[model samples]
Target chain A: MLVCRDLVKSYRNKTAVSGISLDVEPGKIYALLGPNGSGKTTWMKIVAGLVKPTSGTITYNGEPIGANTKRKIAYMPTEPFFYDYMTIANVGKYYQDFFDDFDPNRFEELIKQMDLNMTDKAKSLSSGLAAKLKIAATLARKAELYLLDEPLNGVDIIARDHVITAILEAANENSSIVLSSHLVDELEKIIDNAVFIKDGSMVLCGEAEKIRAERGKSIVDLYKEIYA
Target chain B: MFKLMKYEFRKQLLSKIVILAMVGILELMFIYGVIAEKANTVASAVGFFMVLAFISIMFVSFECAFTYSKDLKTKQSYMLFLTPNSAYGIVGAKVLTTIAQVFLTGVVFGTVIIANILFMAAKYHSVKEVIEVVQQFFKEAMQLDIQMDLIVSLLVYMLVYWILLIVIAMFAITLTYTFLANAKFKELVSIALFFLILWGVQKIAEFILPDLAHITSYIMLGATGIYLVLTALFYLGTAWMLDKKVSV
Candidate 1:
């Protein structure tokens, strides 16, 4: 479970996130819906302890975001952030060394299932394969909360299913998955909660079924209704 | 902490290997020249190694700082900050790794030089004369009394001074990255901060110790103490900034 209050992040002349607050509970998959630069990644980075918020407070189960919570919160940034010299196997080894909950065997399985070679250099991987590598490496961790920023982006249509499956496999009764993507239709059926954000502020947030029934529209429809 | 250091070392493996390979080649050249009894080859090898040693020291001294700056500017930093390690641990590991690398390099160079001296002495059959010549050279060139104890103290003092250099560079670079992260003149600011800190340290040493010119064991020990304290302070300051302000 996680809590964020009045979270705001500002750069020189622009604020990436402004006065956005949300709570996340366990056992659910959250879709952080927004267009590009809507502060989804910034919010996730704040929660992941990668970025310091200008004015806000974020906590995981009553503790502030830090090394302790970092052990339990696994974040997958959209960009390919692996060392240039790392092979797929080396990436797995790095994760294993850093995170105690990281399962090397599971990482190997995910790498194979994603149709990736162990010895292939991460820098040489195509964009799609790189996305799969990020997803595989992230899901391999048995973290309590997984914040995946644009996990489905750059993934091919055929491999999209594998990535989604891997994500679902990582979720359990004790775990929560928060993912951000523009492909609302792809995430519509899987995500249990839908949070719409626009212009660095929360526009709508609620349970997927409740919102659909109350508004008489699917998550994809609502996405278009809110943004367009 | 050791795990972090392990990765830190791994990150620097390629550069270390390059330095080691060059040193190895030079050492082999020296040995070959000695066995072959060619004075010209011996002189060339020794001359090249002295230059190599200077370059190697500069590289080993500042490689981690450069790595830190690169890490901050690039997404590669996520590889480090995403881990469950604290800033203190991360910075501490880097500092410790640099220290270890410098010490290892010193040992390698020291061993080679000592062996080369002994080998030359054996070849010429003048061990006593070689020692006398070294003592005489030091006494005349440095204008200071030459003794074995003084030499050991000076070597230890140099090691401490080297560490001070590394910590000061790290602090300056961290300050630049944290404060002027988006500034256009980032490198200029970093260089300025480095010199400012270095000057501040020098002034403090001057204030604390009056007679810096005269060579004495007490002054050397006192300077060593001052450098060690300054190194620790800079290290802590860098770590604190990293923990409180740095973002990547």
Candidate 2:
């Protein structure tokens, strides 16, 4: 479980995340819905401890986010973040070297499932393949919390199924997955919770089914409604 | 910590290989010159090797500094900061890796130069006499005693000074990336800060040891201790800023 209280991140005159507070419970998939510059990535980065919030408190379980929390939280950044020298296999080894929770066998299996060669250079991979590689590397870790920023981005429709399945497999009673994506319909089916963010603030957040029953609209429709 | 150091070394491998490869080729040229008794070729090789030694040492520090700056400026930082490692550990590994590389480079160049001198001494009987004459010339001209203990102490002092220089550069770079990240001229700012930090450390060293003209074992040890303390402060300062302030 993770909790962020009144988080704010400002870059010079612009505010990336503004006074947003939220709790992430265990065993559920959270679909963070937003347009570009909606603070989803920033919030996720803060939770992952990559970005320090301008003024706020963020914690994993009861402890503040640090090296210890990092051990339990696996973050897949939106960008292609692997070293240029890394091959797909090297990326797996890198994760193994850093994270004790990383499972190399699972990484290899996911790499094969994603249809990527072990020796393929990460820098040379197509964007779609790169996304799959990120997913495989992240999901290979049996972390307590997974922060995936736009996991479905650049992934094709057919490959999306594989990605979604891998994501689902990574989520269990002992773990939580917070995923941000623009593909709301694809996510609506799989996500247990939906958090709608706009203009750097949370506009709506609740159980996906409860919101559906009360509002009589799909997550995609809500996305359009809120943003429009 | 060692894992981070390993990756740091890995990141530096290409640069090291290129430098060492050049050194290797030059060594072969020197050997060929010696075998053929070509004075011009031998002199050229020695001169070029000296330049390469200076270039290689400068290149190593700059390369390491640039790597840190690149990590902060680009998405590559996630490859490092995403690990369950603290900023202190990451910075420490980088510093250690730089020292190891400099040490390796020193050893390689030193060994080659010493071996070449010894080889020349064996071949041309006057080479040993030339070394003694050069030592005598330095002692007479500079009034500096060239003893083994003094040479060893000077090497240690130079090593400490180099480490401090690298640490100061890292601190300035980290400051620009973190606290001054939004400034218009962050690169220029870092450059200026680099000099300022160096000057500040120099001033502090002067304060601690007012007279450095006459070098002694105690003076060398004292200077080394001062430099190391300053290095640690800047190193820790950089790591703290990186952990608490840096967004990327």
Candidate 3:
């Protein structure tokens, strides 16, 4: 499980995550629900150790996140992150070199399922293809925690399903996945833990099914109710 | 660190090919002109390559600076920071790659220099005039004889300086992105800071060693040592900044 307490990240005059504490457990799909600039990405980045929290503590399994914890965390950024010179095959090689938990065979299989080729250069791939590749690469790792930032943003309807399926497939009894996205409808059916964040603070959070039954509304309806 | 350097080297692979190809072409042109006894062609080739060499050196230094800064400016950084590599390893690998590129470049140009010297010696049947001018220039500048020890120390000093330039450049870029990250004129501030630091280092060196006219092996070795230490410090500072300040 990943735990963050009193997490706050600020940039200049703006506060991204304002004293927010969150706990995530294994074997469940988490939807970090938020609108654009609602501090979801910043929170995820802090947990991923890509961004340093201005004032707070984030621990993975009772240890502070650092180079060691990075091995267990797979973070997929919203934008294209591979070098321009990298081919899809090279991307796999990079992961193979860096992450000991990386499964090359799984990566090849996932790429095939996503309709991505090994020979395709990362820079030349279309946005949808790139997004698929990111998911494929992230899922290739047998990570304890996966932080995916806005994986469904700007994706098409069909590709959105592929992404959701990839997320589901990436999960296991020993692994937890934290997926941040504003597109709640696509994620509502798959996510078990729903965390609604608004204006850099968590507004609502609970078990998806229990909350739905108690509130008498779907997660998406709750998203609209909370944020809209 | 080795894996990191492998990717860094691969990133520079294309530029290396293009630049080396140009160098080969220029060298061939120069040799052909010499065989044909075409003075104009030989002179033009030398002039062109001189400019190319300067540009290439500048490119390598800039690439060294931008390699880390680009990670901050572009999303490409996620690919790196996401790895389990420490900031020290990431920055160390880059510095090593820069050194390798610079070393290879020196060897290539050194070969050309040797080949040209041999060519001119064979063509003229003597290097008497060239030797005389070189010796005269050294004597006048240093007010001392140019011994083998002096030559070796000078080479070491220059090599140390080359690495220092790259490390300091990376340090400056890291400082800009981390400290003045949100500043509207960060780039401009970075440039100014680079020059200011360069001048400060130079002034300090000049202050410490004011008697360059009485050059000796010990003096040259001391200067090289200073440069080496500075390179290490700058590299460590750059890595520390990346770890502590830069978010991406």
* Best prediction by DockQ: 2
- Runs of candidate 3 exceeding 4 Å displacement: B115-144, B206-214
Give per-residue CA lDDT, model 3, range B1-248, as digits (tens): 99998888887788889889999999999998988999999999999988988888778756867677777777888888989988899988888888788778867887897788678778877787766766787789889655898889888888788788877778888889888888877667777888887877777677777755366888888778878888889889988988877887
Model 2: which residue pairs collide?
none
- Model 2 misplacement above 4 A: B118-144
In terms of docking quality, model 3 is medium
Q: Give model 2's TM-score for chain A to 2 decimal places.
A: 0.99
Put the candidates in TM-score order, highest first. Answer: 2, 1, 3
* Tens-digit lDDT track of model 2 for B1-248: 89998999999899989988998888888889989999888999999999999999899877788899888889999999899998899999999999888889888899998888777877778886868976787789999546888788888998889989898989999999887887877778988999998988889888889876568877888999999888889999999999898888
DockQ by candidate, in order? 0.81, 0.90, 0.77
Best by lDDT: 2
lDDT of 3 by residue, A20-112 (tens): 998899898899998899999889888887888888888999988778899999998888889999999999999999999999999999898
iRMSD, model 1, in Å:
0.9
Indicate the residue-level lDDT of B223 in model 1: 88
Sliding window of 10 residues with minimal summed lDDT for model 3 chain A: A153-162
Accuracy of chain B in candidate 3 (TM-score): 0.82
